[model samples]
Target: MGIVIKQSIKNTIITFIGFGIGAVNTLFMYPYFLGEDYFGLSGYVLSAANILYPIMSFGIQNTLIKFFNENNKTEHELNSYITYMLLIPLVFIIPLTGLFYFNYDTIAAYESQKNPIIYSFVWVIPLIAIFMGYFEIFYAWLRAHMQSVFGSFVKEVFVRLLISVLLFGVYFKYITPLEFIYSLVFVYGMSLLLIVFYANKIKRIVLRFKVPKQSKAIWTYTIFIILSASIANMLLDIDKYMIKHYMDIDNIAFYSVAIFIAMVISVPSRAMHQITYPITAKLMSEQKWEELNELYKKTSITLQVIGGLILVGILVNINQLYLLLPKEYSQGLFVVFTIGLSKYFDLILGNNNAIIFNSKYYKAVLSLGIVLVLLIVLLNMYFIPHFGLNGAAFATLIAITLYSLAKLLFVVLRMKLFPFTYKTIVALGVVLISFFAFYYWDFSFHPMLNIICKSILVSIFYLGLCHVLKISSDINFVMRSIFNKVFKKQ
Candidate 1:
């Protein structure tokens, strides 16, 4: 647990650094520099690329991690195992490009525009897809070696940094919007190259065609994981794809802006999950069921607390937040809340997927992920036409909620594990009370001061309530330690 906390802290700092870098690009730079349609196109292109990423790579990313951890093979052997497993996906996907080539018109038909920008850009899809597949496998290698920071840095930091530069160039009228969108392929390719270079720094990274002693088990797991990974990604990416089909890139931009804000609430969960994956692998390897169960509870409590705070903060100041965006994008306010809530639910399910995936029931995670994929697509199809941006938000919310619930119920039903107690209930109560009190607070005078004062008031009131209930005594200790440190300085 100490290791989990420490590594998670490192990941937290990395995630925030990445988040800050991304916020600059997403919130200020891109929105300010790019027009709505272009901004929307950038968002849609990325959403499409990422949504396609998992399938293009198959389940090979997660498969690499699990297999590498299990076998403890040599450098060449490990590389061969993963490199070969990865080749199978390319084999099928590469040939299918010819098929996709013939159906290019059908693909562009969904793009809101019937032009070369949409049609020509279709070629980049496979490049982006192949880039993503390689990147994920390399990242999994780093992760398997307990090197999350490099992967985090490359994914969260370097890629965004490159994108930021592109946006800045556009801001100065040095590049056109269409060209900027096309630059995504290069940006991603460079990012992939960076990860490969960094992976070499930490360990040997090469593409040797050495044949691996194939195992039937590995192939089976990979197939299951591929199915799971593809669906999981579809659930995450379907909204961006659907919006472009149903509406225009303008709405995609609006909703993407809202999602960028909403994603802040889940950043910590993603960081923690990185640590949890390796730890779960370790625990399951040792058959430490007891510790795994306890981890489930503590991780859930801590993540939900942190996530709830960020969510509340975002929801409370949403109006002020949109004041930072363009006037047209201010309409995405409700989308922020819906997506933030979805992230909070994800926070509460911390390490749940890791636990299930690392355990004997790894296949079940895929089953649930597939179910949610269908749910998300159906929900988005139903909502986007009726409600527009809000509809997309609601669809994501429904999908993630069901996904989380399914994982939670699976853990409890099959494993007899639960992440609840009286303290959990009290903590949730505190969250509710704090949200209602602060969510509707009147904004007046200095906006920053009002935010600070109301947040402090909420903090004090919530802690007071917690002290009365003895909910999360860790919070009490944290407060006392902070005061002690501050007073000691005085």
Candidate 2:
């Protein structure tokens, strides 16, 4: 737990800093520099590429982490395992590349009718997909070695920092919009090379032709995870994909701003999961059910409280946030609330997804994930045409809520592990009251100043109350540590 907390804090700091840069890129720079169509095109390309990333990697990113620490093997055996992980994805990626190549014209014809900007940049999708796949391949390599912080920093911070510089180049008229889009491919390609270099720098990877002795089990798990990855990608990326279909490509830019704002709440979970997944897998492998259950509840409570504060801040400040953005994007006001709450729901689940994915019941969860993807797609199809962007936000909110609840119930029923308590109820009550109290109260000042005041007051009140009530041991520990350090300095 000490190592987990230490590294999680490190990763969390890195991720939020990255998100800070991303918020600038997403809300201000991209909108101002690229304008809406190109901004949306960038979003569309990335979202579409994400949809293909799972297939390209063949789920090796997750499979590597799940199986890496299962047992110790000789260097020869480990090298053989590396060979399988590296080469197997190409068996899937290459053919998909070919499929995209041959069907390029037909696909472009359909997409251009809806958003012709997609036509010029359609090829970048497969290229970015391949880049993303390899990036994760190396990222998981470092993660399996329990060196996640550096890799996470590179992925979260370095990549966004690169994007910021490139967008500024576009702002200064040093590059055309089309070229700016192409530069993104270069950014991802460079990121991939750096991660690959870092992985080798950590431990020289040796790829061998021999397969592991558990080749049969490895293949089965890899296939299952491939399906799981596809399902997961669809849930996360389908909204942008569908938005492109139903509305102008520019709408994606607006939707993306709201989505990014909402997504800030999930940063803690995202940072924590990188370290927690391998730890969870190790615990499950050791059959330390008690420790695993304790980890589950602690994560749930800590994330719930933190996620609650972020949600409050975002929702209460959403108006001022949109004020900073162009008027065109201000339409996504409801989009932020719906999507933000959905993300909060995801946060409170903690590492439940990791727990389920690493457990023996993974296959069942994979089945449910498939159903979730289908539901999300269907919901988007149904809701977008009738309700517009808000409808898409509603679709996501519904799908994520139902999907998370289902996962929660499955874990409870099958493993007899419930990540809930009297504090869970109290935490919910605290969140609701905080939201209602500060939501209607505003100061007569500049919008930004008002946002700052409300955010500070809400955070202080909410966190102070949580501390007084002793809602979470993890939060209390963190706060006490801060106080101790402060008093020591005094």
What are the TM-scores, per candidate, against the unseen true structure? Answer: 0.91, 0.98
lDDT of 1 by residue, 1-490 (tens): 7667766767887888998899888878877888787787777677777777777787777766665665555777866775686686776687777787898788666564522345556667777877888888878777777888778888888888888889988988888888888899998999899888888888865666866664666677778877876776676778977887778667877888888889998888888887778777787778888998888888888777767767777777777667667799887889888888888887887788777766678786876787778878888889999998899889998998888888899889998888876667767777887888888765675655666676677667766776676664444555577789999999
List, residue by residue over 1-490, the lDDT tens digit for candidate 2. Answer: 8878888889899999999999889988999999999999999999999998888888998888888874247888778887788998999887888988999998888777888778978899889888999899888888778888988888899999999999999989899888989998998998999999999999788878987777787788889988988887878889999998889889999999989999899989988888888898889888999999999999999899988989988887888767777888898999988988888888888889888888888888887888888889999999999999999999989888888899999999999888988998899888998989888767888888998899999999999989999999988999999999999999
The Cα local distance difference test for each model comes to 0.77, 0.88
Q: Best by TM-score, which number? A: 2
Error of 1 at 85 (Å): 4.3
Clash list (residue pairs), candidate 1: none
The root-mean-square deviation over C-alpha atoms between each candidate and the true structure, in angstroms, is 2.8, 1.2
Residue pairs with colliding backbones in model 2 are none
Model 2, TM vs. native = 0.98
Runs in model 2 with CA error above 4 Å? none
Off by over 4 Å in 1: 73-76, 110-117, 206-214, 446-490
